[model samples]
Target: MSGCNKKKFPAAKDVVLLHQLDRGIFTPSISPFPLKLETYMRMAGISYENDFKNPMGPKGKTPWMTFNGNDYCDSQLCLELLASKFQKDFSSDLTAEERAIARSFQIMTEEHLYWVLVLWRWVYTKGKTLWDVQMNLPTGLRLVMPLAVRRIKAQASAQGLGRHSKDDVIEMGRKDLRAISDYLGTKPYFTGDKPTEMDCAMFGCLAQLVWSMQGSPYEEQMKGEFANLKEFCERMKEKFWPDWDQCLSPPRLNVS
Candidate 1:
């Protein structure tokens, strides 16, 4: 891709201009992948800026970024590349076996659990839940919401998650949560005391349930049986997102 000649793209060297969906009322981003990448940047102390101008990048995915005028997409790939470039290894302390376990948890959260949430938010719930959190959506997006839901519905069906009943999807999510909870045990973070790349991805998904999936059983479970996970969300938010409230949509107005 050409250098950032477009006004929306950042021209600064060695600085990441993150292009992702607009922020939501309940979270900095209702989309987990972008939030994951942003959280990774925050944790690694990488210099970056958010650009809501172009939500879709070359690969047709949100959470893409421009570094040194080069565009990169895919949240996980971006995290790995940026980590190497910055010499930051959140999992550098992990043993070989521990690394394997962390990889498994990350895959479960991103692949399986992610589809579950997508089905719930788009297909099963018919985007009602998403509308609740993204209430301040732009007029253009409001017009496109129906088409977005249909596209997700087709994608979920193609992925086989939509073939299952709503109850089945919920059960799958519950089981995934149970596995994560059991593995997490009592550790302050996913891997151990300190957060890792896995935690960045995990928190990206779990925070959605904890904060944005209002009135859903998953939200209730996160706050109930999976209360530890809820606490984990709180911990991650406190550590990486001190400006959480300020990052919300409609902008939180401060009063003296």
Candidate 2:
């Protein structure tokens, strides 16, 4: 495609601009595949590196596994989304093995901070306090743990499920976030460094949290919900979403 294709979803060069993992593994996580590659994605903490000097950070994280459960070619979730959207002649479409793998994770319907509770509980079992982006990970790590906790608490209370809610889930998410906010807190971002999966995950959870909190008289009491969380999301927008309007994918080429 030419650089000036009036509706080029992403300029051809920009199409693969900031790839993180395997190119094939990336598209879907960002949604609608092609457009996601045209835009940037948050890739701070969830990545695995050999050292502080990993030259291949841009090569994209090695696929955790292939969709086919054999040699790694791509991620299943990404493969299906691309296949369904593009319907292409190229053979990278999701295979039967890939479809089976995608089915495995269907149990997790939790979105945003709801899943953060899932992750927090998984990690809390290890008693690991100090977090290093390179070493500590569960993919969707917490950026602003306190905000995530607060958001999850808000999530559970959404339907007056407070008493009916699994108190343990609420308490786990709450105490983890509250404790982190209370102890060694508010550093500008997660890990007191750059943003990571934790930041994105926390941002995912709290974007709505802060949006909802705005204009309320309780803003002052919340300390702007702690500046670090707010700023981190802003930084995320700046880096990954320079042109939010460009997020939609273009019409498929109909390669077949």
Q: Could you tell me how far off, in angstroms, the CA of residue 146 lies in candidate 1 after the best superposition?
A: 3.4
| Number of the top-ranking candidate, with TM-score as the measure | 1
Estimate the overall C-alpha local distance difference test score of candidate 1: 0.86
lDDT of each: 0.86, 0.33
- lDDT of each residue in 1-256, candidate 2, tens digit only: 0121122122232122222222211111221122222221223111111111211221233222111112112223333333443452222344666434323222221232344333333233221221210122233544555665565456445623332435555444444445434421655544444432234434444442333223323234335444455555566556765653343233324411
- Which RMSD values do the candidates have, in order? 3.6, 18.4
lDDT at residue 20 of model 1 (Cα atoms) = 89
lDDT of 2: 0.33
Best by lDDT: 1
Residue 62 of model 2, lDDT score:
23
> After superposition, which runs of candidate 1 have C-alpha atoms over 4 Å from their true positions?
1-8, 136-138, 251-256
